[model samples]
Target: MSTSTLDLAASLRAWGVIRTPLVRLREIEPSGVAIYAKCEWQQPTGSVKDRVAAAMVARAVADGALPPGARLVEASSGNTGIALARLAVMTGHPFTVVVPENVTAERIQLLTAFGAEVVFSPAEEGSNGAVRLAERLAADEGWVLLHQYENPANVDAHAVTTGPEIVEELERVDAFVACLGTGGTLMGVGRALRDVWPEVRVVAAEPPVGETIAGLRTLADGYVPPIFDPTALDGRLLVRLGDALAMLRRLVRTEGLPVGPSSGAAVHAALRVAERLPAGSVVVTVLPDGLERYLSTRVLELDAEEAGGLTLW
Candidate 1:
């Protein structure tokens, strides 16, 4: 369906967007230290990528790079594709998402439910495989690719919106922790925080090299997102899968926060940062998404022997 520029604006207005909340974790923080979590799951698609998707599509349309009703293609493990799929439907454009076969079953179902075409790349190659496949498809078929890994719009979205929200809510941020995925959140929010308070430390919670954690990536994994700058980070901590999963359970049981694995990793890193800081320090982190999409992954489940659950807490 060919859509005119006039109709594009109308289509865009039909969807409701939101400014997600920033909640301070006073109850869960150590004495004299404060930690906050920006709740991105409150977005339209229940993920932070909602901001990225909206920004990318709107900018494409405004810049005339994306003609009305042009098909958009992307590679994602889940959240970005889900956000793009919802936006594609809203903006009267069809979208195609290429994902690795190992992505959670819920994500595939969510993409299908959004009426977007889903293609599976090899699981062994992970997101890079999906990227390779998407690049080929976009080149061969003339589909416009919204390459989130390299898109300036992804960074701009967080800088213009998310960054200000944090600075507005908190008096001062001593450290900002975020997982390293496409690096948009880390780079954009880090820059904004540093611009406001030059001493704000930007820390990264990365999965161990050669280890797998959904929605987070290690730099040594062969594909570094173009937007990522190692120099911007004041510190980098390696989160093991076991530790991340353990934190996920702890957060759920103790704080009543059922966030995904990457969020857990960020929280773990944030806590460590808080421990070393002097009293009255503030640290902010991001909770990217909720547990709904990740239930199918065993990270949230117990083994048959421990099916009754960990009772010793």
Candidate 2:
């Protein structure tokens, strides 16, 4: 390897933009329960998916699967697409993102703004439809598909970096909670924590079926991700849309964290698990992204009737 390339690879590990802060949320729950959140939204691409995107691209290049200036394709709700779009540009690869038609205008605009080719799948089918369409495109044109839903690197990124970061900071984790999308974070982080603490409870926080909560998916949905395994989780918590919205508001006001709906849902489930645990138990949750990606949606603009029924669960 060239001297310059070796230096670049070595310095990449110490890059300041790659690390994010972990916040210990004391006021969000009872005195006995301690809730720690990994604020992944502070990443360079503004989401936890940045880690996955970087890993996938690096592996593809190293394995000679992706040539210089190759074109790439992927299916994402918002965060992953945006992360890949940014990375593709930086790495001199053209990217095409197939997303749900119902996604907020803010996300669509951001993807296009990053110079990514954007395609809209059917709104009724949600993210699953985007996956189908992207798969077809990948097969037809021989495009390099990052396939986050099935990629092992997606899980590995969290297992190596995100999970160890939490274990290092908190020392011990009684319970680990994360929203279920493609199951990368839950599976990767869960396995990492279990390696250290065999009794650590791995919980999944998912939105109720038939709800339009972005960034989350229920297992009841017809298409289960290839990487998802029910046996990996200790339990699953169903979060309602109204309750998630309420928690979003509370988090912004009380904790000063303007997190996304999926994050709010994860926090809600974490608090539920915390309530059942003994005093001084530690619970860690992953906030996948912040509110910047959901500004054009109803995430922060709930009406009176909608807000009234949602009690903090």
Candidate 3:
């Protein structure tokens, strides 16, 4: 690589948005299947969105879309906003994020800590509302909107980095599971994995219609991201909020993995997929973020009744 290219790579690594570990869950082993998780919370911003944010910012800079002192804005439930806030600081851009008012207090606090302005959308409308509000704000204020839902950079980030990392570590992957948000992770990683294991199943774990799981969305709920290709998925598992929380608790208590609700949902789906596969099948899932962002919400204390309902699909 050229000197400039080498320096750029070092800078990205220093920013803590590079490779993360793909670890086997030695304790939570199913009968004949091996399960692994990509521990993405290790990133500086404590979420897998760090990769998307870094890629979007770098693309914006290279394309000259982000001029000197340009303002940056995005719509996020939590992780993406926090990740973008940190990148905005590094790039010397003023940052703003639109989020549902019902998001956890810790998320708001983290965004503020990174000096990003927070705008509230109607909580009842969820993240789709946040996206609409962000679009208006970006247009009104002339802020550069790094729209994760439509941004190719979001998928490209995972395709180039996250997917390759997993394939490098695992010689054969039977199935890849992850939460369905903007669909970037599944789409990007799915494509990469398929390149090696042509028959590898790409599955998505999502909340059922009208249900809410932290950092997850269902396409049945009206808004499907433009980048999402439904044909790419082998299966779409509808995981309930309560079931996801139960799985999250299991990971923390049994597996010693302190991951967020989305991670829990992904693992829950992964296990379901594993049960149908042949013995010795390798199932890998992405843990999008850690538990720290959920501390203020008392997530660990939440019981099944308090967490809503449980259903498997």
Candidate 4:
């Protein structure tokens, strides 16, 4: 690796993107069944995507795919874009993010704050449209598209960092649960946990078909991320928007954990898995991001009647 890439790596470490806390949710689950969450929101950018962004950039730089000051582009709902934007600033790379127009205002502001050019895809088309548009723009402008959905580094990031951290903290993880976006977290961490406990169940919590959760997707929604392997998962749970919202509020009010919607979906699924497992079973889940990004959207503040009509971005 070049000196610049080395410096970038060092900067990432200095910025505190590595080794988030694996905290047990003592208040959220039964005493017999233990539930632990990887507090990824503690990352510098307050999202698990920070790890992916750092790993992707490092690998790209090392591979010479991203030479010094090369422009970077990506499609994100929010977290990944914000994460890569911060890294772009550190590396002196011009960054652009293609996002769905329906994304929260806080996300757009954060991207702009990091000096990233933001492009909006049609709101109705959702994130898939953003992905398509980003690909076209990257092709036309010759920008480096760090497509997180298919990036091998996305999986490698969790495999090396997130997975290892969980293994080191827990004696046995009978089940691993996470929200399914690009499926990198579940795939990578599931593989790692399974290596130690071969029977460890890997489950995904995804939104139902045609419904949208902030950072999760149903495989039935026409785009299966290339890095996702169905064989890696033991099961998939359909978490409704209301259920995720309710659980998000529960995590905040009951556990005092300010986590995002995806984390809510993850914990919802984790609870289901925990209920079915034996008394001594351990369940681990990933809290992908923080609640700050969703504040403008008022997801947490929605009343039950208002929540019924809520359209998720």
Candidate 3 lDDT by residue in tens digits, 1-313: 2222433333456567868989897766588899999999898889999988887787777667889899999999888999999998988999999988878878889999999999998776777788889999999989999899999888878887899899999879999999999999999999989989999999999854246434335556567899999999999998877778888998999989888888888898998898899998999999999988887667788875664421111
Choose 2 or 4, whichever is better by lDDT. 4
State TM-scores per candidate.
0.88, 0.89, 0.91, 0.91
* Model 1: per-residue Cα lDDT at residue 252: 75
Per-residue error (Å), model 2, residue 211? 3.4
* Regions of model 1 farther than 4 Å from truth: 1-15, 212-221, 302-313
What are the clashing pairs of model 1?
none
Ten residues in sequence with the least summed lDDT for candidate 3 = 1-10
The residue-level lDDT of candidate 3 at 310 comes to: 18
Give the clashing pairs for model 3.
none
- 194-277 per-residue lDDT for model 2 (tens digits): 999999999999864335424335556567788888899999998877677777788888899978877888998999999999
Give all candidates' CA lDDT scores: 0.80, 0.80, 0.84, 0.84
Please give the TM-score that candidate 3 achieves against the real structure: 0.91
Number of residue pairs clashing in candidate 1, backbone atoms closer than 3 angstroms, sequence gap of 3 or more or interchain: 0
